[model samples]
Target chain A: MHSISPADFAAILLSLKVGVTATILSLPFGFAAAYLLTFKEFRGRVVLDGVVNLPLVLPPVVVGYLLLLLLGQNGWLGALLNAVGVRIVFTWRAAVLASAVVGFPLLVRSIRIGMEGIDDKLIQASRTLGAHWYDTLVTIILPLSFKGIVAGSSLMFARSLGEFGATIIVAGNIPGVTRTIPLAIYDYAGAPGEEAMALFLCLVSVVISLAVLVLHESLAMRLARRREP
Target chain B: MKLAVEVVKSFGVFRLAAAFSSAGDRLGIFGESGSGKSTLVNLLAGTMPPDEGAIFLDDECLFSREKGINVPPEKRRIAIVFQHPHLFPHLSVRGNLLYGYKRCAPENRRIDLESVAGILKLEGLLERGVNNLSGGEKQRVAIGRAILSNPRLLLMDEPLSALDDELKFQIIPYLKGVCEEFGIPFIFISHSMTEMRLMAERVIVFEKGRIVQQATADQLARLRMPTSQVGYINLLKLGPPRQVDGLYAYSWGGGELLLSFPVRRPDSLIELSSKDIILFKRHPEAISSRNLLRCRVVATFEAGNRTGVEMDCGGERLIAEVARQAAVELEICAGGELFAAIKASAFRELG
Candidate 1:
């Protein structure tokens, strides 16, 4: 209650950076996976779907362990990555990677629901009007499913802000670096006589999450108004 | 333009196999619902490839399973007007009209934006959104959009089937506007015989996904094979309508037809049901009926519970359905001249 602590400022800023980076970097894959799941037909589609959703049901620690063996030094992929002089373990890049992995399923599930809700007749109509499949996807499917995209993006952004279990295992709690709000709260809660700092960090998380949701709601409403037919 | 199509496709228990070749622009395909008319339209538009067949349009192979030549809908130089005016809701009328226009190459393009807008009478509604336009107006904009794409041919899948009767007829003339302006061949698929007669120079009748008959208008009328909907139809040219005794008089074929509507269009299509005309062997005088045509019977046959007579009146063939007892009592037979008495009502407008 005395003043703004340097540690709290660093944690908040780091949290925002990781959440935004995770959202922007994972968006393309999320869209591709959701659109593919909604439209395409091939063998093992259900199996591929299950694989994308595994992160949602499986424990976060298990996910972090898999990432560790795959990306850590002396591991198969890690050794290859080290050869390229790119060390991601115990760094901010690893923090973003962990957040993206944890939040991707939510993003894809919401976008897929959006794509499924579109009227299929419109897609067929577009094709008949001299538009290729790719053109139809961009002009008809994406514009109509924009609401779902907004909902998914905001949900993923909020989820990434609160990521903790997997992020701690992979990125570690390096102060002024990979330590985000959740990690900072965990640190304060673990110390003696630091309950105030923990509660302040919790309040900050709630405010940021609420702001994102409110902003998303307003933008979604504007887009929907423009689409009234 | 010439079209040759022989295709076979199956969906679950339903199968569609149609084959026909014609060298006309204003062609009509008529069939009942679920008779694969829509599927045939899709095959023509190149949106759905035929399972096993070939389609040739003016020497250009649109689809060939053997030759591996399947031009997609985008590159086929074809346009479609569906039953519902499936306009893009997010796009304004201008955007909807310009979508294909911008995508088409300049060499393939012939009709410009302003010409189509003027022809379809959509010049004023260019900026309006689809939701703001009426059903008729939306259909007009749809026609404009299809024409502006500079298609070599247009595929109309019951485009006017969604509108009401008066509205449907009102838009029929608009179709003529396009036909006269662009001279682009049209393959119209519809279930209504009235619509087929109005738009088609050559008619192909479909039943259960098979080509039952393909002939001209006169040849089709002669083949009155008693199919429930379009048994025997006589088209009359409507003259200027005048009200008399609270009924409207429309003159055609050296006579007049009385109706209830205040129809004003001259040369409009009026369909008279053959089953409603009463036969008079003695030419009864002072009868309540208005139309009493002296005709020579060309043929007579058993049609259900009645006698079907194909009569010729001044180079025009007419079909009249008379009861079996009346026909036997009047001694109705082939090559016998008789008077056909018809009441003042029983007239329907097709377009």
Candidate 2:
């Protein structure tokens, strides 16, 4: 194999950085959404649930375009942010936002399953035992559904690593600032006489995804065993 | 605990409208499944709010639709022991017990973990995980956890209904003893008449979302004797027995009674069905039955097809059921003398 170029190395590092940053940023909001969807009763709950799950079913390109419109330079939110001198479009932050929005439903769905599996009686027992709602949420709900959180985070991170359509439209294909592994691969595939480099990056993607899935499976098994024994 | 509840709650087709007050230290909510007993418990514990009306615990308003006063379960200080143990799987036995104790307010914290563990006989299992404990031990830990909260009232919602007969009786002592020792009043809920008799002094019976009866457990038992499949079980507490000619003889109120079941425990409870006792006009010359007592009838009540004769033999009370025709032929009356015979195999040890 040909020695890897510096630009490719930067792409690889940025892919991992964006994946990690997106997953971390989405954790609290994901948990909150899952908690509300699973436990709370309110008006328009079904509507809120439908909205949360929209990005999962929508095409990635359409999601990217919708996000572009929402955070464009002349958009309301973008203009408000510009008043405070902060830029989000065509930057690494835009890549993070795009990845987060696309992967959010998966995160929320996984955590919601975990939260739903918890017996209602356990929550009632905690309350009658003198735990306030927030106290019970922190002590009981959070710990009991931690496996779901971990699984969701891992799945979302893997999804973010492969983000393409959204990242290209929102973050653009900058060499070091915004281009990730997939974008780099797309660039190499288009250029003549760069098949080997593309194939090598493809191999790297396969390795990273496999490692994450295997780690996720092993962590889940370990959690199940610890809970039982 | 003095609880006054007048609440109405509905879930689709089933509606619960309960209104009652209880001041007893040990109160039993007796009802069959789907009788709204659990709904009443939820309302009392503040885990579920009532659609209308109010609830007062010792005259302190816990919930009131008119006043817009609805105290949450935590602030109500009313703990519950659910049918299943429901212990936190991540926590050890000690952690589960202290989960409530740590949350209790300082001034309201009267029972500590040590005392709860000691009372529930959970000292050795404290460090062990809750998943590994036996069913009875898990229930003991649950009761201990509830007690450690130092709640003003503990609602035990069929805590032992999930256990087998032997385990049910074994945990009854811990359930009763823990509450008594801590001076925490509790409402015991169960469908088992035996459990109600053993645990609660006064019972509020529920039938189809309504309070049908509120009376002593014994009175309720007698009232249902004609209809119950097991007619009026007479619970007898006897001391350790001595072996006599292949029979176990335990002292009664002031006399001796022979039973076939051997009881190793120092104090044991035995049940004898009312139908097991036979009445005779005079002492027979020879009989297969072992116990023959000279007794005077204290009272006579009409059971379904037979008459229940309340008799006093050697200062102890025993009810002997006889056919109405035989009662009339034998001239069975409140002040008449009669002879009662019971076989040695008739007694069954309960706990």
Candidate 3:
């Protein structure tokens, strides 16, 4: 850590911050979309599912380009935010937004699969026992689906760590603010004979992903054991 | 408590049209699967709504098309115990019990946790995790949890179906305590005739999405609601302890049944399993059946794999389920005279 350059350290810190913030910001929306898709019987349910998952199948560059068109300085939303002196485009917040959009489908998919696996009888039992929907969600749905939710959050954080295509176009490569690990690696790879630095950043990304996955697995194992008779 | 249901619901080719009002506290609905027993219970629980009809409980409309009144389940003060326990996996047994108990309106909280736990014998299980409980233990906790909620009406959808015979009988007394002791009204749904005879104060027979009849067991039998499917339940008439067959005897119909257990209560109802009754052409000489009565076949009906011979002894009506081959060999028919031999152990006393 002492031998690492200041630019490399900034890239690592910024990546962690952006990845964590993006996952936190998207958690509510991800859970809501997944719950709606899994439980509710409504018109256009298929369309809602498809829209939530669009980011996963769409190209990252297209996602970034579309985000740019919608949030650029001259863009309507951009102008609205600009008039309030709040800039979301080409800033650290923009990095978080880009990561959130790109990682949302994975989060929702995992949570939805978990929620779908729960017994419908349990929900009915809760209702018959005088629990409202919100009470059931808090007492039954959320706790039982925690495994999938945590797994999804970890996956989204890892995805955000490696995000480059969308992050570059929208958040830009500002060193301290938005130049995360992937952007830094991209910069190193582009420079003449900076192969060693780029390889080091790639190794760091792999380690971070492994660490997150390990944490999730251990927590899931503990939960499994706790549920055992 | 009173339940008045006049509901019509259709799904695909299946249709359910039932209208009945039972003032009895312990009511049982008996039917085969696909006979809409579960569907009717779901309707009562407020989980499933009727397509077109009205449901009322003590003048308060639970569901009505014209009134535009459909009360949600939680507010209906009705609770259900399913075949499976359906305990919250996230909560401990105590937590699950308290969940409903705490949520009930304070003024209406007649059923408390301690009393329920005591009745259901859920003492040691309070702190255990719900997922870690045995099947029978889970069911006990489930009953306690539902009872603790202080529901005006309880629906049991084969709650003991998942248990073994030993566990099933063991838990039956607790159910009696719920009705007889606590005075809570409940509707139990099952396909088992024995269970109905044991639990039902008023028996409702359902067939193919409709309630065919609703009456006491004796009335139900006399009504001839397919006696083959539902066995005979007789109210036992106790006499002073007599050393008959070296055991205490109780008079049933024209004959006396010697029992290992002493019959003290005159109100005890006993079920005679039709499958256990044996028909003989003659009085039969060296057999240990102990009780035999001269019977004349009142009616006969085909019951799928077997023939049902309804016999009349004095005023008692007993349906003996006989195999088709046996019925043919024995030359059993309406108005035929035969002796019905009941093993001393065949009598199951229910109080």
lDDT of each: 0.84, 0.91, 0.84
lDDT of 3: 0.84
Runs of candidate 1 with Cα error greater than 4 angstroms are A1-3, B217-225, B229-231, B264-269, B290-318, B323-338, B349-351
In the predicted model 3, the residue pairs found to clash are none
User: Ten consecutive residues with minimal summed lDDT in candidate 1 chain B?
Assistant: B221-230
lDDT of 1 at A200: 90
DockQ for model 3 equals 0.57
- Candidate 1, A129-163: lDDT as tens digits: 67899999899888878888888899999999989
Best by lDDT: 2
DockQ by candidate, in order: 0.56, 0.79, 0.57
Give lDDT tens digits, candidate 3, residues B1-351. 788889998999999999999787888898888889888978877888999889998778999988898999888888999998988887889998998888788998887877888778788888888888888889888888888888888899998888886677667877777656677789998887667766787888889999887777545554443345544444344555566556778665666667766654554556667777889998898687867888999987775657778889876787787778899999998999999888878777653
- Tell me, per candidate, how large a share of the native contacts it keeps: 0.54, 0.82, 0.73
lDDT comparing candidate 1 with the true structure: 0.84
Q: Write down the worst ten-residue block by lDDT for model 3 chain B.
A: B225-234
RMSD of each: 3.0, 1.7, 5.3
* Model 1 per-residue lDDT at A9: 95
Q: Write the per-residue lDDT of candidate 2 for residues B217-333, one digit (tens) a residue.
A: 987887777788777888888877889999989888677899997874665678898878889998889999999889999999887777888899878888877788999999999
Look at candidate 1 and tell me the lDDT of residue B72. Answer: 90
